[model samples]
Every structure is written in C-alpha cells, then in structure tokens.
Target chain A: MADWVDACATDDIEEEDVIRFDHGSRTFIIVRDHEDNYYCTDGLCTHEEVHLSDGLVVEATIECPKHSSIFDCTNGEVETPPACENLHTYPTKVENGRVFVEI
Target chain B: MPRDYDLLGADAKSAVANGLVTEDWYRTHLDRKTMKALMKRADQPAIWDTVVLFGSMIAFAGAAIALMPSWWSVPFWLSYGVLYGSAMDSRWHECGHGTAFKTRWMNRAVYQVACFCMIRDPHCWKFSHARHHSDTVIVGRDPEVAIMRPVVVVRMAANLVGLTDMWDGLKRMIRHTGGRILPDEADYMDPVFFAKTIRTARVWIVIYAATLAAALLLQSWIPVLLIGLPRLYGCWHMVLCGWLQHGGLADNVLDHRLNSRTVYLNPISRFIYWNMNYHVEHHMFPLVPYNKLPDLHEACKFDFPAPNTSFFDAYTEMLPALWRQRKDPDFHIRRQLPDTANPYHDGPARAAA
Candidate 1:
C-alpha cells in the first residue's frame, strides 16, 4: 500500500513549469510538461541540494538554477552531470481535478 | 608594493573582515513586471546569431585557405580569427549564464563551442563566473579583475596579443588535466564540479594534441591556424573591449554604477560583444538576456551614470586614468552621474554625503 497525498489542484502548475510540494518534513518537485502531464520527483538537485522548483522546465527536463544540471521530469533520471545521481521518482496521479503523489 | 588581489590572499581575508564579501550591494529598482520581461529568454535571437557567427567563420576560413601563401590570405584569416577567438568570448559568457537561449540544450551547445574557442574549462569557468556576478569587483574576492592598481603596463600590453591569457589558460588546462585545481579556484568552486572540470580539461588537451599532430603530419600551419593558434592572433579586440568594462573604475564599491562602465559601441562591436557594452546593466541584472540589455539600460538609465558616448570617448577617459593609477594605486576614475541619477551610497561616498 502507498500513501498518496493531495499535492495541489490540476491547474496549479502550468505547462513548462514546476511547483514544490511539501508534506511534513519531506519535499518533492511536481513538474508540468509541455503535454500537460504531471510528474513528481525528489525536490533537491543531487549536485548542490538546490531546489529544482526554482529552475526552469524545458521540454521534459528540469534545469537546476544553481548550476544548470538538468533532470528528466518523466523518469527522474539524470540527463546532465554535475548531478550524477538520478532523483527518486514517485508515483503521481490526477483524480477529480486534483493532483496526488504517492510518497 | 604591489597590492595583493588574490582571492585567498590576505587582501581577501581583509575584505571579509571589513564587511565586503557577501554584503548587500545597491541595486536600482525595477518594476516587477518589467524585471520579469527583461529576464525572459528567447531562442530565436540566439539561433539566428549562432548561424551568422558560424556562417561567417566558415566563409572567412574558406577564403583564407583558398588564398593561402598570398597577402590576401592575411585579411581573411584575421577576420576568421576575430570571429572565432574574439566574438567567442562574449558568446561563451552569455551562454555560460544560461540566459542567452530559452532552450537549455541550445545554450549548452553554444557554451561548449565557445568554451573550446576561448580555451576555457566549462565547469571551472562557469562557477568562477557565478562568483564574479555574486561579488562583482569586490577586492580580493573577484577572480576576474582585469586591471589591478599600480597597473602592470607590460602585462596589459602582453595580454593585447593574447600572450598572457593563452599562457595562463594553457597552464590551467595542464594543471586541471593533471588532477590539480588552483587554491583560488578551489575557494569559490563547488567540490561537486572538480571531477567534471578535470574530465573537460582532459578532453580539451586531447583535442589540442590531435590538432597539433595533424599539423605535424601534413607539415602545414593550416590545422593550427584554423584551431588553436587563432586565439593568440584574434584576441586583441576582446582584450581591448574587455578592458573598458572595468579598467580604472572604482573598486570595492557596492554600486555597480561606480565599479562598471557602460560604453556605447558600434553595432558590429555590440554584435561581437553580445551587448556586454552595457556592462553595468548586465552586472545589475545577470538573468537578463543579451537581447534585452538595451531595454534594461533604457529602463534604468536614470539611476546610472551616463554611458560613454563611444568607445573612443571611453578610452580617452580610461587611458589617462590607467596612467595615473600606475603612480597612485589609490587613484580611480570617479564617473560623474546626472542630477537625475540616484546618489551612490557606498563606503566613503556615503559618509561624505
């Protein structure tokens, strides 16, 4: 069984944008791709612990503002170095116009 | 005695103790929407410019090769070198900031190309530039200070032909390839980038070695001329334009208006320099794209000192100031701002006011 928490409304994140979702002490980044799909991953950049939400989403990749390391939003895979580690991806779903992520 | 400008030297420690490092610097106010508009990045301008730049480089190099061993070859090669070596400096700078293009990959591609042209290690220079923006012209903290007081005339002259920069760049690349980072570089660079920096250096060395081997195998200067050697011959304009940005300007000041110069240059120079002639505006708003710099300048001109009328006018003021600074290290060019401009409120200027 997975604990799925309500992150935000479906309309909260626009295309090519990201929002930071905090549940208790944990934080995650929810990104909206160009196709309007939502994906969730660990919030911090593996390179320098910078918030990925502060960065820009280009196509399907989220570029870290600090050092420009990019991660694929779809798979939380490291697409660029300086960040050699892939982010942990969480299961995300939209139900009844609300976005939810399994933590 | 020559002043110590080293980032890890006593001067830097003194700057920290004197409350210079990481202190809040003055900024001209911009409306939120206007600021947002200026920061907006676009790919069209960058793509168009990239096409033009590379297109010009290829055309010029072709002309040079066709005219080889003739006096006509000199002009074509010189043009190619300027495009490759000089213009690449600004391209490297803008792309490194990641604000030149809306697409991340596009910026990265241009950055890599410009990095190779300028002989800069992308990983190291990227972090160094971030620090430069964070602590602009802060004595002891800034790694990119071009002209230190008691100006070293001979060294500055040597830099005009790229002798100094190329030698230093080679030394740094060798050191990086050997798995060593300078203490000053280590001071500001994140430890996470060290391995990547080394790897990049190794790649650059291999490329250069290959180019040299190609030239030796063919017994022709063409390979070197097209690749590594152009940086030395074509770097004069870059050094010339770069010195105007901050040479003889105020140092250790919290206001960029005091520390940086914005000179009006011709369209060609602006294109080559990528609008960095608006140096103060760029420093003030590092996120602003190069295309929007003129707009940013227009928006904030009231708060800034008047831009130099032209490059010649800027050098007229700068040359004499550099001359005086050689005798008096404390001397600097204090620019006159318009009455409409806000007063600079840093250091002694504030107390005097």
Candidate 2:
C-alpha cells in the first residue's frame, strides 16, 4: 500500500524549480512548474543517474545537465536523446502548503 | 599483438563483458547544494567569449582578404584560421554538451555553427562524443581515443596540419551525402537521429560547394580560404592540445584519472580550447559547465592525480610513454593518485601498471 509521504513544504521549492527529496531509500524530486503545479519524479536521470535536481528546468521539461537529455517532469517521459528510458513519476498532492508524494 | 580500437571489433565485446561500459567512476562527492551551484548555467561568460571569438575572426578575415596576394596577409590569415579552424573544435565540444549557455537554443545555435566551421556533422559527432564520455578510453568502445596503441607516428604527424583528419572528414562527408552511416557509427548512434545526421551532411556539401563556386567565379583563393581551407591550415592548435588529453595514458581504464590528463596551458590556448585543459575534471563531472571548470577542478583536485604543471611538463612526460608504447603496446603512463584520493574505483584495467 502506498501512503502519501510528506516530501517538502510547497513553499520550499520556488516556482519553476526542482528540489531533491529522499524518502526512506529512494530519491525523488519535488518540482514546482511555471504554473505553480506540484509534480514529482525520480531524481536521477534515466541515462546515467546524474541528479536531475541539478538539471535546467525549462517550464515543464527538465534537461539533464550532464548530457542534455530532456524529460517531462509531469509524466516522466524522456523528451530528448542519449537517454531513451523515461523517468518514474509519482502522484503528488498539496495539503496546507505541504507537498506529499505517493511513491 | 596490438589491441584493436575498432568500435565494432572484438574489444567492444570485451569492454561489455569486462563491465567497463558506463560503469560508475569514482567521484569526489559534494553536497547537493554545492553541486547544484557548480552546475548552474549562465549566458554572460559564453556571450562574451563568443562575441570576442567571432569579432576577432571577422577583423582578421577582413584584413586578410584586403591584403590577399601579398605575403603581408599571412599572419592575419593564420590568426583567422586558428579561430575558424582550430578554436571552433572547442566550441563544438562545449556547445554540444549544452553547457556553454543557459538558454538551450543558444547552445544549439553555436553548436551548429561550430560543427560547420569544423566540417563535422553535428549529429554524428554529438552521438560520438556521448559514447566517448560514456566509455572513455575503453578500447573498442570510445571512438574518440586520439592516439590508439602502437601510436601511428605517421598518422599523428600528418594530423598536426589536419592532413589525414580533414581528408577523412571529407570522405566521411562524402559518404554522408549518399545518406549512408558507417557501420561502426551505427553501433552507438540511435536510429531516431539517422535521418537528421544525413541531412546535416547534405547541407554541409551544399555550403562547401557554394564556397568553392565563389572562389572559382572570383578567380581567387579567398572564398575557400575563408571556408574549407582553414580547417587544414589552422588545425595545428587543435591537434597540439587535443593529443595531450589522453595520448599516453592507460587505456581501457574505468577511471578517468588513469586515462585522462590535465595539463596547464597558456591563457591564449585556454581561450582557444575553451578551458578543456581540465580534462580529468571535465570528464568526471561533465555536468559542470565550461566556465565553472576551474571551480570544479579546485573542489576535486585533492581526490585525483595532480595536474601537469605546464604543456612542456605534460609533453615531456608523454613523449617517452608514446615512444615505449610503439615497442610494447601495453606500456602506459600510470597515474599516481594523491594520498587523499580514494583507491582507483574500477576493475583491473589491462596493463594499468
């Protein structure tokens, strides 16, 4: 059974930003898109596991800083080359300014 | 027998079997905040560098064209060639990594421009370099290994002036015009990009043809000199600095310190090479942008072998290694890790001793 785990405060991540969140053992990212919608995805790039939190966030897509592999944070779908596999995403919720992710 | 460096050959399979393909190399771990700061991208440094590079190129080219047919123009032409022929290699590299500028389009724009200047098909080289980083110095896996074992002295000497390199580039470009990818290239290239790779080659042929036509119509060597010939004339700097990157280092090593060199270069050469003198650092944390390489080098310098003090120092060390490798292919310059460095985090590399 999946439980909504508190990832971070909604205000902790700025708009159009991503912050790394480690829950138990797995690492994920809390991304606040340009429209202020909260999203969650695996923090490591599918290609080489370089942290996606270090990557450039352009609206909805996060570009890998190492090789420029881009992915849609919303769906975790790879949007670029050199990285064929899509990322694993989690359902997220915002409750009273705190962000929770069902991983 | 000499080791096979062919990407599709036996050693390619060996690299896979040996667990050398994309194995995690040792890193000097830093906090996420620090790493994020180091990886942050900005546009100003790249903007200033690009403006200076192109601005000087235009000045030199204009002066050279005006003074053409006179020996007085030689110096200006040489300067122009270094910018167009040699330095563009670094631009192609940095922009290809998408770290040169914060804006994605800017990196793409410069990458395409640099690819044309270097006579490199952008897509082909992009994938080639991606593989290079993924499996650096692994025999038969890394296509960009500059000096393969037994050190073909003749080929190395010829490439100083880009004779063999440009010749091969021309041949590759010709093959690309026919919409054919070399079988070896196909091994690592994604099928998704094959069409655009061929398209890029076709576009280059048109551009080169136009430059040649202009020269013929004007009854002058000016147009070709401005375009195609510079890659031959001014490629010396590229080869000089590029060879020092991994010329005599241990091959098939999972650790970059074992296979890459960091040499101190003069400021002018650093500018020309886009700070790639920090070779080991660049290979280790490729996410770090070119402008931030010095900072990254500082952060991790304690964890690796000390950088060569100078170009002279680097070559002095490499020359004898190369000479010996010609006799015994397995003989290589073993890197001495610093006391603070963690033990080499890798499987036993062949002949690492």
Of the candidates shown, which would achieve the greatest lDDT relative to the real structure? 2
True contacts kept of each: 0.04, 0.48
Clashes of 1: 0
Give candidate 2 regions above 4 Å deviation.
A1-28, A32-37, A48-60, A77-79, A96-98, B348-353
Candidate 1 interface RMSD, angstroms, 1 decimal: 4.5
Candidate with the greatest TM-score versus the true structure = 2
Segments in model 1 whose C-alpha atoms lie over 4 Å from true places: A1-103, B347-353
Question: Would candidate 2 be rated incorrect, acceptable, medium or high by CAPRI criteria?
Answer: acceptable
lDDT for position A86 in model 2: 93
> On residues B92-199, what C-alpha lDDT tens digit does candidate 2 reach at each position?
999988889988899999999999888788878888898898888888998888888888899899998898888878988899889899887798777777888888
CAPRI level of candidate 1: incorrect
Give every collision pair in model 2.
none
The TM-score between candidate 1 and the true structure equals 0.82
